[model samples]
Target chain A: MNSMVEMQNVIHRYSKNTIIDKVNLSIQSGEIFGLLGPSGAGKTTLVKLIAGILKPTEGTISLKGTALRHLAQMKNYGFMAQSDALYQELTAWENLDFFASIYNLSRKRRKERIRDVLEMVDLSSFKDQPVETFSGGMKRRLSLAAALVHEPELIILDEPTVGIDPVLRRSIWEELYELKEKGVTIIVTTHVMDEAEKCDRLALIKSGKVIALDTPQKLKEKVNVTSMEEVFLHYGGETK
Target chain B: MNTFHVMKRILIQFKRDKRSVALMVVAPLLVLSLMWMVLDHDDSKLELGAVDVPETMLEQLSSDTLDIETLSSSKAEGKLEEGTLDAVLYFENKEMSLLLEGSNPNAAGAIQKELQSLREDQQNMVDVEYYHGSEDLGLFDYVGPVLIGFFVFFFVFIVGGVSFLRERTQGTLERLLATPIRRSEIVFGYLAGFGLFTIVQSLIIALFSIYILEVFMDGNFLYVLIVTILLALAALSLGTLVSAFAKNEFQMIQFIPIIIVPQVFFSGLFPTEGLGTWVQIIGDIMPLTHGAEAMRGIMLRDASFADIQWEIYILLGFTALFTTLNIFALKKHRRL
Candidate 1:
């Protein structure tokens, strides 16, 4: 399978502190890839780099064989940051419509995609409600729906399920799997162990460095662990 | 086409935020109307004290417009110091000497005006020379155009700057950068979106000031709209640029004193002519100064488009420069 994203020697810094240090990783197409790390481990920064919302201080990030500097190539992916980022005063449907329109989808396509994503997030009934009235979990789902609205080949979600309930979280995971079956490449960042276990492959990041990279089963086996939590502890503690 | 999407989204958002809509449209109008009422207040009666004046002159001065009081010189000085008497007229020599309270320029101007007219009617006095503005000019006629440009620029600057800053703080701007949209497109999208309401705002305020409030409107209405709109554009661009430096809404408000107040001080609302050359240079750098100057030129002086063309270009130049800086500022978030 072709690599959907390629980060070579990516080094990102804020002021004098290095956030992403000389790291390299390749994300294959049509797989659920999880970046698991503790808080402040630069997971958000690295994901933002891949989503083309930020630039690397010392290397290159390419999406679909094209450098991110070419803005046209960025349309191939959808990005969701930790924040819901919805227009508070606008209705949920209007927010989705705005994003869909930015992608230049046909009016019919825009309506259909908006309906599909809202249903996928179980927010179809609340489409006309203003986003300010939405609960935290509802807003998170809406943010997911917006990221999925354009139906791009790649999706980058940063802590997408942080505030969601377990049942709704399971539903969202099922939807993400369904998209993966449709050949969409998903890159999700999370500190949740069970969620990390769901990814086809995991990159265990610690202090801005990816300490281990493999399938969850293989990683656990290599660490002589039964759960991803043990594998994370093994690496996080061993590094010290 | 992409710009239209951004514009549409902004308009939709505006529809939902009724308070912001009212603030942008109604606040300026309310303040301006209040200013008109104050500036266009009916001429006030003057209190005059006659100290050692002939009874004939005292009788001439005693009318509905002037209330003359007979008092000793010391008593007259005390009354003037107490702000009771507007002025005290005394005759020590053949030459006339008038002691004015001198506080409140408007009251002083009123006293001077009444005395000038009194002198004229009594003796067919020394011929008064004509100047740039006729003697019939009211304070509203002089300050209306400045306030018009000022309110538009002020409100648009605050609203545009704060909204753009919110986009940053709320993470929407980062989300926007992730899309295929160019930085310039985002900036232009905001311009087109905000630009629509700005035009409407300018039209309503200009028309009301001219037709309803009866401010001086000697030139083309179209030119007035054009100047006001350009001033708004300058404010919009400068405001967005300033927002990049501000981290939050409070920091944005802090800019009012630093950026907005200086412009008002020299926007020709007061007499900038008496200011030193270097101080006047500060006015030249302020967009409001040029905007107000152009507005006054068109409204009061009947200046044609060609006459105020330089100011229009300066305003446009300020917009272009600030917009370019804003686009460059976006590079910090996303290099492309």
Candidate 2:
């Protein structure tokens, strides 16, 4: 199967310290790939690399067989950053329409896509309300709607469910699954182990390197552990 | 096209954020109105102490402009020190001398000017005609052109810088970069978007300064609009460029003293003709210096486009340079 993303020995540094060490990753198409790590373990940096927002200092990243060094390649990337990143003063629809226009969707298509994404995120009722009045979960949903506005082939979500309640988190995961079923590749970074288990493939990263990469069952079975927390502790302890 | 999208996003945000919009448009007008009331005072009464002046000369000098009080030199000095008197006019022997409270520059200047005119009356020299301004020109008329440009530039710089800084702090800038839009497009979008609102702001301020406050406008109104708009663009580009270095909104405010205040001092609100060579050079580099000069030339000197063309090009060049730096600055966030 062709990989949706290919990072060959990527190394990214900030000043003297390396934030992402020499690492290799291949994420398959139409699969939910997870980068699991603690905060500051370089998960956001890795996703940003794949999303074409940052350049690797010592290696290359290719997205859908094209080099990820130009802005043109980012058209396929729908990035939802850790923060909501929505314009709080604008209405939810305005934020979605802004991103839709940024992606250069046609006027008619933009309206359709915006409506669809708002409905998908269950935020259509509050579409006209300013985002500053939104609760945390509502803002997150709006941000996800904005990411989905362009109907991108690849979605990169960084810690998407940090402050969300369990019910909303489950619904978001269901939406992610729906997108995956539609042949759209997804990359998610999270510190939560349960969320990591929901991904088809996982890269357990620590301190700038991926210590383990496998399916949830394989990773748990290799360590003979019943829970993802144990699997993470098993690999994270060994690396230390 | 993506640039236009960014512009639209900014305008939409402005629509919802009424406080910021009011700050940009109404704040300057309010301040200018207050300044007009204060600086355009015509009945400025002065308190004077007559020190050993002859009774006849004291009668000659006593007018509505001067409220004369006869006192000893020591008493006169004490009253002057205590702020009850603006000046002490002493006539010892045949020569005339004046002692002015030097702390208040305006009071001192008015007294010195009045003293000189009294001396000029003694010689009876014909009153010199003003080429650019009338003898009736008030301080507001003199500083109104610069104040207009300064306020527009000031409000736009703070608002624009804080707005861009918030984008980074809120992570929207990174999200924007993750799109297919180029970095230069982002800068251009801000210029065009903020440029539109600032155009309205400039029009309101220019019309109010000239028509409402009745500031002297000797040249074409179109040129005043052109100069204020260019000044706003310079401020906009500089604001965004500086925002890259600021980690938060507070740090952005800290730039005002270093970046904005110095420009005011040299922007011809006061005379910089006798300033130090290097100080004048510092003024020369400030975008507002050129802006204020051009504004003064147009509104006060009735200068044509050719006279202020150099300033126009310099302001445009500053905008371009700051914008190019902004594009390069974004490379720190995304190399591509």
For B120-209, candidate 1 gives per-residue lDDT tens digits of 785666677644456667899899999999999999999999999999999899988888888998898889999998999999999989
Q: List the residue pairs that clash in candidate 1.
A: none
**Model 2 lDDT, residue A229, Cα:** 97
Predicted candidate 1 versus true structure: per-residue lDDT over A1-240, tens digit per residue: 999999999999899999999889999999999999999999999999898887888999888888887888878999998998988989999999998988889999999999999999999999999999999999999999989999999999999989789998898899899999999999999999999999999999988889899999999999798999999999897655
Q: lDDT of model 1 at residue B201?
A: 90
Model 1 DockQ reads 0.84
What is the alpha-carbon lDDT of model 2 when measured against the actual structure? 0.91
**Clash list (residue pairs), candidate 2:** none
Q: What DockQ values do the models have? A: 0.84, 0.84
What is the docking quality class of candidate 1?
A: high
* Model 2: residues with Cα > 4 Å off, grouped in runs: B49-59, B69-83, B87-123
Identify the runs in model 1 with alpha carbons over 4 angstroms from their true place: A238-240, B71-82, B90-113, B116-135
